[model samples]
Target: MSDSREVVRGLLRPQFREATPYGAPQLDVAVALNTNENPFELPLEVAEAVAGALREQVPHLNRYPDREFTGLRKALAAYLQAQTGLSLPIESLWAANGSNEVLQHIMMAFGGPGRSALGFVPSYSMHELISVATGTQWIAGRRDEHFDLTAADARAQVQEHDPDIVFLCTPNNPSGTALGVDVIEAVLAASRGIVVVDEAYVEFVRPGTPSALALLGGQPRLIVSRTMSKAFAFAGARLGYLAADPAVIDGLRIVRLPYHLSSLTQAAARAALEHSDALLANVEELKSQRDRIVEGIASLGLTPVPSDANFVLFGGLSDAPATWQALLEHGVLVRDVGIPGHLRVTAGTEAETTAFLNALAAVQR
Candidate 1:
């Protein structure tokens, strides 16, 4: 109709004019392992419970959902307490459609023109995307050659940038390495503003790794963001939440839209949380498969980084893009994260893992 798309582009913000949306390729492949999603499907009993809960709320669709989502918060608090042995109050919990939205709410409340946020390079892409969208300056800090941050290095970077918000991604994505608590504490001490510890993959962490939730008390500016999408196999449910001080949670409330959570979402999440044990029964199995992938790739002579998360990032490819395409030709899909020789693959069931390994070995030869 008259170059409406061009007209829209001409009126867009300068910073966004050249920006492309963030997403991995969504292709129909025999084995999909790109997005780091939990490979297991929800247990049938849990799914049935979610369906029943949704049906119970269907009649009340005409009414607005509980704006505070009080019940969901209580469930989350209880879940955290049981998981971490931390006595979390309901007021310390907040949730959104997904952790991305939860992050947006934090940015809206604390970030804006003239303020800056800093994050280590090659972490979650969305952290920078959201910062730019909210008009906050995004500062890219460097990580070491191995993608690991030491306490001294982290503190130095934070002190140098003096950003208003600092992001720490544990079990960091695209690399699958978890940060130690000392590194986190060092950054917190160095920065004078908010410190967001993104723990979306925390549930898959190796044994003996501690969660940031244990550091919540007395650190008013610390926020730990988590998601059901990864470990709980609730990616389809779109439920992400954060644990922080009550004051921090209160700030998010000011930025969130009214009744941001729908009745159906609340019901489904609550039902899943009720059967947390059954829902998480496959975690060990996934961990085993993850180990298998590491071993299989290594046996082929590829360099797979030691991973604490459900995905593995490997290097040693002569050309990552070419290998990615070759793997796809074999009906297997993995993530080419723009790193020169690295690609990321999510751990799937034993059969899926076998298919991926076979495809990779064939492609390598």
Candidate 2:
């Protein structure tokens, strides 16, 4: 018989290694915006609270954490209530090691071999990658030339593929376009399958952008996923949650590992939630920075996509990686999306934005 390792290797799914490259760039720069992370730190009070929680639970490290994460879940539910103006009770909420895992769980529970997952072209690539990993077909519908999805296009795709799941990233990544809620509702009405609205960057958008959570209770098949990674400055903490119907939450729970979140992770996230005010203050600042960065990019005669998120995507940089590398050479790092003639820059602090502009001009020279 063949060796166990050899057998396992042969059995591994072909899609396992077919992932798109995604990770933050590490460069020695005063302002780094390669990833869509908040360019701020957790508030002092929240950090202290997290430390306190960890110290209080230090003696219990030997014991397994509460498998259900009841406390952190409740805090998250409350925070969502205040943030989204949606009455998301703890029963309607579920957490994973991160929102990334939450989406994976969704794919596992609702998508597989015969089923398919649908998303818009040039949206977050992770959605496509996750669908492939689940042995599901990943179908992408191209957006209009303006980088906008039409109501008719959405309905047509939903009717055609009739996917088991549809993933939409609000303030859609790499493009910086925010799909309207009315358009989203139209898609949901046409879709017979589950619809996941990823609101990872919603906080950075202007108020009243109409989050998918607003339509949550009314639509049983709708799930709104959020992460504390961007506006909340908790990327390293790796926390994200979902607000959905009880049935959907139950489905997610089926695929999750017991104690998927460590006690420390739960504590850190809870502390961050407790200081949402401070975190959101930082969000407001990022919005300001986004405006300034967009203006600066426009001043350079580049076309900057109108972004309601923490990052701005611009066209005119035909060779994105080379442009990105040039910026890096000048001690500034930005994201170089694979799309032709496109580049994205996160809005850092005021000084960082200026530095990036200077570096950009220098590269052009």
Candidate 3:
């Protein structure tokens, strides 16, 4: 081997030469709350159903999966209708390995060399990373002091950047604040390109927070991406999807690999969708735990942002990295999102929440 490191560096894309991979720390700890995974495992009933569905597919493994993933799309459409009462046509849906990939496909179609993407800061980091990976220029926008984006502010940024794609994250990551419908409309009006509303955590939004899906009917350029990772507790399955105009679906088809979804994946996702009610039974309880975390953290004299997602982001630490290490020492792990004085923790089972709170309190003292 002739200097493997140098050879790899020479072959790597210039833009990616200095980039780090996107991920939260995966550590073995008594409590792992870094990534916002659903704390509950699949219920026995759903697990059995998934198993049965997968078993049925083994006999047909010789054949490639449905190139269109028709059944999976229909099931997803049905689930969305039941959950959000949005009567979306199956043609309006698209899915891939995860919402990240779904977003990547969007960038492939609409963003690339000489194009650009825009997202507000402290939102989902993946938006920018995916854009850069697609050779699209990334523009960082602004949010208010409290991490909320106003319609006027959003429109101003859109006008200034005029990117080929705009990413708006509802119940935005790291901050956990949901956007208003007005903000979505304003951004749509301001942008001539595809606008992606990332609702990855929408299932946990507080009442009165409407989904951007409501605005999808008239706006052909609008795309709302969601995932089963958080609420359905299906992160390992890696099924992320988006809803948009049928024309947008047609565009995604051009970029996706043929039969991108495996037979097992399609079958398992369909099975899970069939039992969505059962899988989602834990949502309210998880929301309760999330609220408990917010209140508990606030009671400890830390500043916690109001959340519509399953995690809480709190500040007031003397040193966030030191606090993260201290919490890990006490058998708890939370995220230090490179935001000074801030840390994010997922809502776990009640006992886990209590343990985290107690650990945080002890560290504070």
Residues 8-123 of candidate 3: C-alpha lDDT, one tens digit per residue:
97899998777788888888888899899999999999999999999999999999999999999999999999988999999999999989999999999999999999999899
Per-residue lDDT tens digits for candidate 2, residues 269-292, read 888888888878887889998999
Residue pairs whose backbone atoms clash in candidate 1: none
| Model 3, CA-based lDDT | 0.94
List TM-scores for all candidates, in order.
Answer: 0.99, 0.94, 0.99
Question: Which ranges of candidate 3 are over 4 A from the true structure?
Answer: none
List CA RMSD, all candidates: 0.9, 2.6, 0.9
Off by over 4 Å in 1: none
Query: Which of the predicted structures, 2 or 3, would earn the higher TM-score when compared with the native?
Result: 3
Ranking by lDDT: 3, 1, 2
| Candidate 1 lDDT by residue in tens digits, 62-113 | 9999999999999998898888889999999999999999999999999989
